[model samples]
Target: MPNLKHLLLLSCLGLSPACIDVPPLEDPPKEDPADPDADFTFTATPAQEQVLPGGTLDCDVRLAWADTTGGAVTWSLVSPPAGIELQPFTLPKGETRATLSIRLGAGTEPGAYTLTLQGKSGTVTKQATVSVTVGKAGDLVVNWVVPTPGKAYTRGPLLLQFTVEGGAAEQVEILKDTTVLVKPTGSPYSFTWDTTSEAEGTYQLSIRATRGGAVFTSAPRTVIVDRTAPTVASFLPAKDAVTVGVRDSIQVTFSEPMNPLSVTEAAVGLKTGAGDAIAKSVALSADGQTLTVTPLSDLTAPSTVQVDLTAAAGALTDLAGNGVASAPAWSFSVPTWLPMGGAVSAVGGATSTESVVLKLDHDDRPILAWAESDGSSKNIYVSRWNGESWFMLGAPLSGFSAIGTNAATPTLAIDTAGEPVVAWGETTGNGDERTVFVRRWTGTTWESLPSPTPPSSLDTLFNPSLTITSDNTINLFTSLYDTAGYSIICYQHSNQAASWQQPWELHDDPYLFNPGAPVSTTSGGNIFVAATVFDDHTSKRNIAVYKGKEPYLGGTTLGNSSTTPSIGADSNGRPWVAWSEFDSAPQSDGQIFWARWEGSSWTAPVAVNTRATGNSTPSLALAKGGPHVLTWSGIIDSERSILVSQWSANSWQTMNAPLNALSAAGTPATAPSVALNSTAQPFVAWTEADASAASIYVVRINR
Candidate 1:
């Protein structure tokens, strides 16, 4: 081509004559050829490089050891991956380095890729290698350190952390047992778990990582959840507490959250000192840690109560499913224990005390009737309990201007309508002639029957025992001194306003004489009576028992042989018979013994009192349907105290304290009668000896 400036200038001169002359075009200088003796070498910034699909990697390849000869070099590339794009790059005529830009295809396959650069000088060609590792579709790697096997985690986070290598990750996930705990995290490969709602147990943890267009999974690992067993942190009405109100609820606090259904009435027991379980209900607090036990009925006052926790019944458990380590039991005292009445006698005391009879009124409070012998005459009196003290029901009902020598032993019982009924024997005509009179409470006041329970006859009347059957029938059992010799009599007063029926003979052996007082109770419409009858011909006296459809004792004897018998029944109408038997040892008078009817037959009569010297007048009673209690006069070492015992462990056990410990030579503990309220707590009353000036004393059995 010709120089273009001269032509353009000549054309401009002709067109305008004022055109400036431009310098004549000149050819550039040519450099010398590259030295053929120089050596050639090549290198890359990174020996090996990596790139993810749809990603780029910038790298430098240096051609060092160049000849600098200015010899023109020819450049070309060799062997490049199909998914890799080598951007156009050229090295200067004599340069040391060149840049390589590698781009990966969006859908590239995973494999090793090689990129080569060739520098040619004359007949020689020098090459450098650049490796570009393109990641596959699912190229993201995932790994996790698992929790220790059988490991336990407290109340905190249970985390699942994973490490990703190779390619970049777009999402991650963690899965627990049957649940996906960690959802897809856009960029993070770790997940944290909350341990609160989870129960104590073993579970599996798994991980999944997603990168590009593929997903990867990790082997499952184990995770644990645990919490300690709940503990009894504190309790209300603390151990051995006193003066607690009857209505107060026992509250128990726990150290940790608990399962509410585990706390039950059977799991937590409450019992009176008499070893009778109290009526109660269970309540759980909103926090699931506190439990309150409320008494369904008022607690018997001035009594010790036991609280028990059952370990086997699964009483309480923690969220971890752990139960109490042991069965726990404790006790507290109710100082306000209710007393039926105190000192049922004159202000200064009386000359003598008659047998005291106890009965529970409709409301379950006690009503007592007893006789006081002021040296000359025996007076019969009635009284009602106001929970604390006692007051006379009415003026002396008997033992005053009567038709008998003196109104003697009086007995008490409640009628069908929950009315108090009292019966006593009074002397009439001659000193030997006696009659038994009857009176019933009209709810408002005491009402006297038109006729005596047992009409007077030529025979002397002994003390009588009375019981009201479920059908509201009043039954009378007594020992009658008839012309046919000593005989046991049975009288029934059909309805409330009915007259007495002709007495049915229970035992009428001509050889029987000097009969002791008789006691009786009814069970399941059947009657049980116990009495001591002495053989006139022989000095031997034997106790007799009768079980009949009616109120009379004519059944098999309780013991092999016995004397001075008494009887009682549980709320279930199960009868318990107690009596005195002469001991086998020499100089031993009698030992108190007892037996119970377990529906089919009587239990082997078991001896109650240990002191064989002088045990007499066995009396029996039971907590409505709970433990049984029996009392008797025990004269040991010449002390003459009322040694009381309770029925437990299938035997009689002594009270924590003796019922009567009066050791005074003139003082005595005699004629004890045992009774129980609706709650099954027992109350025992007896005459404190000092016959010259005696009083009726009462004590409550607080287990």
Candidate 2:
């Protein structure tokens, strides 16, 4: 035993007497602990898990992990307390990856279900969370190609396609108001329903499917069937129409395809004001849309006919088994004859000259150009019919008279290219000075070319008649006058070039009369111009035709002195000449006379106006296969008015007095020009020659 201090020292060492006696002790053996570093991972992201009732999850999920401790791992669900089954719940030893498969029972609620999984290697453990949601499944889906919503559905074949969802695909049916449109037992079901025999209306459609002993019906879908009757889309010789030709056939176009056999003689008929005309035959168009009726005799003028479309069901039924919307009786009046029209508006105030040019286009619309006084200068103006009234085109253009020059003789002609070429004569300075200015409508603005003649010249060129042929040959026929009087002149160029050939004289002899600037047209192989010559030695007037080249006169007609002679050629190249001649009946007063040029010679002159005390300046117009329109000015009933006459089938007919209803009824209407549109409607334009002022007037004789 030691003292107390010795005992305290021994206690501080905290060793037993036996330990102090032993030499250095060896280290104790190490003990293995639970593995806390073990981790759970996924080869791919844990899928948003789901399963059908009594079915396994549709996705395959792999749960992978690594553990340092040598032991097996386990996987289990912690939520949904019980009901859910996880397959291969344990990741046994040597298994780095384990597949998790789950099954849900019918009683499982369709909501989010959380599944907790755990894995352990020896004493190490890890957890993972998997959440899943459930939903009600779809069964049968019905889709329609025809009768789609918010569209104009017509009576026709209706197409439908069916998609079978996770339901009993053994039996499926699509119905419209209990009528089965499709009944099949397959996954891809398609059906076509012909509504040709169904009445037009709206209805509901649904799909029914049977799964074992249960049944499912889809939501309702809307369907519409339109079986409406056809209507008259348009009719030739339309309702309330006028100026219809004498040899027109009755044509009726329906709104839709019709039964070809339905358009028979008994189904449709035509009746004149007097009695019914038998139909020779009824023909349907290739499309089964248009019905044409052949009459026993040709339809002529001065007759009114009514078209009767049958209302009987089978007579005019469409493919949809419906008759026309209504049995419309339409009436169109054939012109009492030719040369029939009403009043048209006046241009300017009234003062226009023989310079007024009228061109009848292929559409039968009339275009005009003239010189007028706007209180200051004589500016040129042009107007065209916009189907209703005359619409002025472009701004008033410059005329020679505007600058205090000599006379402004404006002339116009249109090319096949749709460009209007206008030319005029003006004296620029005080001395022997005059030039023929030419310009063209460049589709937008007028482009002026160099003067045809020197700015200063002794001779004056007037009555500039411009013509552009189909081949774009620009020809200018004018009257060059000096102290010796009128000479026929011509200037040539192309519409594509700015330069004109040297001015040449067609009839350079001053003694010959280039009647009305040799009115020329592009209707023949060579340009045709109607010219006149006065034999001072014989004192007889002769109407002559000039060709484009050296041999000037093709033919000539011996007659009394003629003034302002006009010429026109029909589509057949038949030339017609009309002019105001010196009449001895009224002691040298003007008389309107016309003559036709046969291929061999001229026909004897036919007097158009004898009763009129004075008549002059005949404007001639001929249609391709239509009528001959002749317009002029004369005194009718002691009042100066514009007059018109038509020659057709070797017959001449007078028209209603154009100025018969004008406020200035007695106003002298001169320089009458005529043009015919595609409808064979006549458009007449003239100058109101009042003592105080002159203005332009227009009228459209529509059909």
TM for every model, in the order presented, reads: 0.50, 0.53
List residue ranges in candidate 1 displaced over 4 A.
Answer: 1-342, 347-350, 374-376, 399-405, 453-457, 507-516, 534-539, 549-556, 571-574, 583-588, 598-601, 609-612, 636-638, 661-666, 690-692
lDDT of 1 by residue, 46-71 (tens): 32244567766555565544434444
Lowest lDDT sum, 10 consecutive residues, model 2, at 16-25
Top candidate, metric lDDT: 1
Query: Per-residue lDDT for 501 in model 2?
Result: 83
lDDT of each: 0.65, 0.62
| TM-score attained by model 1 | 0.50
Lowest lDDT sum, 10 consecutive residues, model 1, at 16-25
For each candidate, C-alpha RMSD in Å? 32.7, 29.0
